[model samples]
Every structure is written in C-alpha cells, then in structure tokens.
Target: MYNLPGLTIRTISVSETNNNVYILTSKTSGAQVLIDAADDAPAILSLLADAQEDTDATTHVSAIITTHSHWDHVRALGEVKEVTKAPTAAGEDEIEAITVPTDIALGHGEVRSFEDIELEVIQLRGHTLGSIALLYRDPRGPAHLFSGDSLFPGGVGNTEDDPDRFLSLITDVTERIFDQLPDSTVVHPGHGNGTTLGAERPHLAQWKARGW
Candidate 1:
C-alpha cells in the first residue's frame, strides 16, 4: 500500500502470469480507479472488497483502465467489470483487439480524474500498438507511473526481435517519460517490485545498445 496526500495505491498480484491489478483510491472522496483486471475474478473481487474495508469508507470503482489488450492483462476484465459495473477505459487503438467492451477511449495526454486525483494517459507503442502508461502526480511528493508491461526494473517492455518496435518504445519512453518527469518518479510496473526513474536512468544507453 502506498499512501499519498490524496490517494492510496494498492497492487494485487493475480493469476499465473503474475499480472498486477492496481487499485487507486481517492482519500477524500473514496472514489477508486482500478488498473488492469488481469485474472482470477475471485482474487480481484477480494482485493476490491479489501480496499473498501481498509479505507473505512464506501468505495466504488469509477473505472477500470487497461494498459493494453494482451490476453494475460485482461483475462478477468469481463468478470471484474460485470461485478463492479464500472466503465472500462483503454487506449483508442486497442479497442479492436481488446476482448471486453470499452466505454472510454483514452489517448495521449488525456486526463482521467477520480475525485481529486488525476491520471495522465501516455500512449506508448511497441509492446502493443496501443499500450499505455498512466502518470499520477501528487501535490505533496514525487509522481507515480503505472507502466504496465511497458517498463520494468531491468529494462523496457519486451519488444521481441523487432528493432523497429524496440526503437519506437524506447523513443517514447525516453521523451514522454524519462525526459518529461523527474528522476524521483516512482514506477510501478505490471509485475514485480517497483523502481525509480533515477535508478534506471543510467542504463538507458545500455538498453538501446543491446537492442532488447
């Protein structure tokens, strides 16, 4: 659990793929936004319930945002949406590939607000045509990014052997993310532990040179 002045962020690892389902709740209004329904409906539902309990307020998920349309990232999307009845949002280009219905089509620089907290959507291509990362800026501290699988501790998201895709992802990540945000920014990816921009900054050239 990560507590900011106006928000509470929790990550639940679900399914065999170890997909991360993040629940972001506005401390003032108890409005929540869930990122990635990943898998295991029962586990996802339990996480939602636990968040409500922990907050001690009537919490409701305003929307469920998908990072991309990968199967492992959306296995429980339908179930979670049906149970919560919250609208779903994803990158506009992903609408065709997604398995679940989308209520909102997000694009680069679009802002999604949950009560007083706002998340800026960044469209990052390569991992998928419409892969996105959400940037959350707290008034009192460093910003946070939910990078999905587009970023991780060791390197950027997997782009396979496609040099073009790797270049595209790295370019966007460098400009839209690394260059725009402070090094102190906290990056919470789709899986595993979190890392900071400063921690990964030095390795950018290495990642590019290696062509991963």
Candidate 2:
C-alpha cells in the first residue's frame, strides 16, 4: 500500500508470473484507475472492494490502462474489464495486440486524468513498440511511476537481444524518465518489488554497458 495526500495505491500479485496489478484510488472522489489487469479477476475485484475501507467514498474504476501488449501483462484484461466494464486504455502502437479492445489509444505526452487523479503517459519504446510507463506526480509528496515491463529494478525490459530495441528503451527511460523526474520517484513495476529512481540511477551506465 502506497498512500499519498489524496491518492492511494494498492497492489496485488497474481498468477504464476507474480504480476503486480495496481489500483489507484482518489482518496476524496474514489475515482480509480486499474493498471494492468495481469491475472485473476476475483483478486482484482477484491482489491477494488478494499479501496473503500475507512471511508464513505464510493469507489468506482474510471479506466483500465495496460502498459504494454505482452501476454503475461494482460492475461486478465478480458475478465476484469468484462466485470468492471471500465473503459480500457493502452499505448497507441500496442493497442491492436491487446486481447481486449482498447477504448483509449494514448499517445506520448497525454495526461490521463479522472477527477482529482492525473497520470502522464511516458512512451518507453523497445520492450514493445508501444510500451509505456505512467507517471503520477503527487502534489504533496514524491512522484510514482507505473513502469510495467519497460523498466525493472536492475535494468530496462527485455529487447530479445536486439540492439536497436534496447537502445530505444534505455534512451527513452533515460531522457523521458530519469532526466525529467526526481530521484525520489518510486517505481512500481509489473512483476516484482518496487524501487526508487535514486537507487537505480547510479547503475544506468552499468546497464548500458552490459547491453541488457
């Protein structure tokens, strides 16, 4: 659980892959955005229900955003959306590859907002052409990034040994993320524990040198 001034983030790990499904709820309005319905609708629904705890706010998911088109990342997309019926969104280039239809085709630099919540889309090309990470800059605290598979604790996501893909991904993550955001930024990745930009920033050169 990550609590900010007006926003609360909850994560559930599901499937054999240990995919982290995130639920971001506005503390006041309860307008929510479900990020990566990785697996298990029952688990995802329970996470949503838990969002209303300790408050009278009526929690409802406004949108479902998939960070990329990878199968493991979107295993539960169909069921979750079928039940919640929330509009789905994905990066423009990866939308067609997703199993479920995406209602919002997000381009780079678009701010996806709902009531008091706003998430800026940062295109992280390479892991997938349309791979992306969402940035939530809290008004009262450090920023949070939903990095998906494009970034992890040690390095960028896999590029299948393709130099071009790796370069594209690392470059975007460097310029668009590391360069623009603060070191206090907390990264919530898709399949593992979180990390701070401050912790990983020092290894940027190492990752580039290792070519992974």
Candidate 3:
C-alpha cells in the first residue's frame, strides 16, 4: 500500500502475464477505483478484500477502468465486475474488443472523480486504437500516471512492427504526456515495476531510434 495524504495506491501482479492490477483508494472517504481487472479472479478478489478493510462503509468499488481491450488486460474484468458491481469504463474505440460491456466510453481529456480525487484521461494510440493513460494529480506532490501498456521502463509498448504506429505512440507520449507533465511524476505501468518520468525521460531518443 502506498499512502499519500488523501489517496492510497495498491498494486497486485496477476496471471502468468504479470499484468498489474491497480487499486486507487481515497483515504478520507474510502472510495475505491480499480484499474485493469487483469487476470486470476480469486487473486484479484483477495486484493480487493484487503483494500476494503480500510473503510467502515460499504467498501464497494465505485468504478472499474479498463485501460484497453487486450485479452491479457481484461481477462478477469467480467468476473471482478460481477463481484464488485462497479460501473465499467473503457476507451470508445477499444470497447468492441472487451468481453464485458463498457458502461462509460472514455476519451482524451475527460475527467472522472472518485471521492475527492479526479483522474484525467489521456488517449494514446499504437498499442491499440484507444489505449489510454490515467493521470492523478495530487495537490501536495507530483502527478501519478497509470500509463497502461502505452509505456514501460525501457520503452513504449509493442508496435507490432508498424513504423507508423510507433511514430504515433512516440508523438502522443511526447506531446500529451512528457511535454505536459513534470519529470517527477510517477508512472505505474500496466506491467512490471513503476518508474518515474525523470528516469525514462532521457532515453526518449534511444527508444525512438530502436523503433519499438
């Protein structure tokens, strides 16, 4: 559990794919929002149960945000949604690939609030037509980015050998994420460990040159 003044971020790695399930909770209200119900239904539910202990209220998940519709990213979405009964949200273009119906179609610059915290949506293409990254800006600290699979520690997501897709992803990451956000921002990717923007910023040229 990562505790901030008003929020807590918890990460659970699931399945053989090592998909990362993120649970963002509001400390004051105990409102919770889950991102990417990845895989392993039993494991995911256990993590949710542990988080619920922090609140005396109903402790139900208010919403489930699916970063993309990739099979690995949503393998357990339906199961988790059944248990939590939380509204499911996903990018409009990627909705067709999701097994569960998307209650809300998120797009660029859209904001959704859970308790006192607001998450801004950023549309990033390449990995999929509607890949998105969620941004949470805390008043006292630097911003936090749930970058889905659009970014990772060494480089961006797989482009399937498409140069055009790689270009699009690079442009979006530069203009929409890197250019606008500070280097101090913490990035929690869809898989693997988290990294700060400062750590990955200097290697942009290397990533671009490698064309991954």
Candidate 4:
C-alpha cells in the first residue's frame, strides 16, 4: 500500500509463484490500472475492489497492462480483462507472445497516460525479448518503477544461461535503468518483494561479471 501525492498503489501476491499484481489508482479521478494480471481471478478482483477505498469517485480499471509475455505474468490476463473490461497494453515486441489483444502497444520512452497518471515505458530485453518496465514520476518524491520480471532485488531476471541474451539484458538494464534513473527510485518487481535502485546500484558490475 502507498499514499503518494495524487496516486494510491495497492499490491497483492497471487499464484504459487507469488506473482505480484499491482493496482494503481488516481486519487483525484479514481482511474485504476491493473498491472500484470498474474493469477487467481478472485484475488485479482478482490484487490481491485479493495482499491475503491482509496478514492471518492467510482474506481474503474481503465487498463490492464502486462509487463511481459511470460506464462507466470499473464495467467489471469483474460479473466481479469473480461471482468474489468479494461483495455490492455504491453510491449510492442511482445504483442504476439501475450496472446490477449493489446489495445496500446508500448515502446521505450513512450508515455502512456490514463486519467491523471502517466507511465513511461522502458524496454528491458532478455528475460523475454519484449519485457518492459513502467516508470511513474511521482513529483512528490522518488519515482516508482514497475520492473516486472526483467528486474529483481538480487540481479536481473533469468537469462537461461544464454550469454548473448544475458548480455543484452544486462546492457539494457545498465543503460536504460541504472544509468538513466536515480538511486532513490523504487522498484516494484513482478514477483517477490520490492527494492530500491540505490540498494542495487552498487552491484551492477557484479551482476554483469556473474553473467546472470
């Protein structure tokens, strides 16, 4: 749970994998966006329902955005989308893998705005070719990054031991994420818990050397 300036963020873990489903609601407009409909329709629905307490106006999910095309990240995509009737958005390169029809194809650096919140898409390749992270500039404090499976606390997402893919992933993460963003940025990962860039920034070279 979070009480940012104009936004309210609520996250729930679903499925055996402990996949994280995030609901971001604009306090002013009550526009909601569901991130990574990972699993358990009942739980996902409940999370959305619970988010209503954050705003005065009617809280409606305007978009269901997928971080990547991975099975764990999208298991409940159709059901959640059906229940909410929200338009879906995903990385442009992942349109085919995601299966669900994506109403908005997100590209790197593109700003996707719904209601008062605007998320900037950042493409972090390798865990999956089209894996992406969404950045929200909070204005009040540190920026928040919905980093999906591509990024986590310890290191980058699994590259399956392919050195080429691993390099591609690490390179993108180092440049697009570590280099561009500040150390205070908060990273909300696809699974497990959250971490800050400052906590992980010092290990960039180590992560690269380890070749994960």
> What are the clashing pairs of model 1?
none
With a 3 Å backbone cut-off (N, CA, C), the pairs that clash in candidate 2 are none
Off by over 4 Å in 3: none
lDDT of 2 by residue, 99-157 (tens): 89999999999997877789999999999999989999998899999999988999999
Q: For residues 1-212, could you state the per-residue lDDT of candidate 4 as single tens digits?
A: 98898999899998899999999999988999999999998998998888788789899998999999989988899998898899999999999998778998999989989877799999999999999999999998999999999899999999999999999999999999999999999999999999999999999889999999
The candidate 4 region of ten consecutive residues with least summed lDDT is 47-56
Question: Residue 66 CA error for candidate 2 (Å)?
Answer: 0.3
Measured against the true structure, the TM-scores of the candidates, in listed sequence, are 0.97, 0.98, 0.96, 0.98
Report the lDDT of model 1 for residue 175: 89
lDDT digits (tens) for residues 18-118 of candidate 1 = 88899998777778899999999898787777766556568888999999999999999998999999999999999889989999999999887856669
Return the TM-score for candidate 2, rounded to 2 decimals.
0.98
Worst 10 residues of 3 by lDDT: 51-60
- The residue ranges of model 1 lying beyond 4 angstroms of the native Cα positions read 54-56
RMSD of each: 1.1, 0.8, 1.2, 0.7
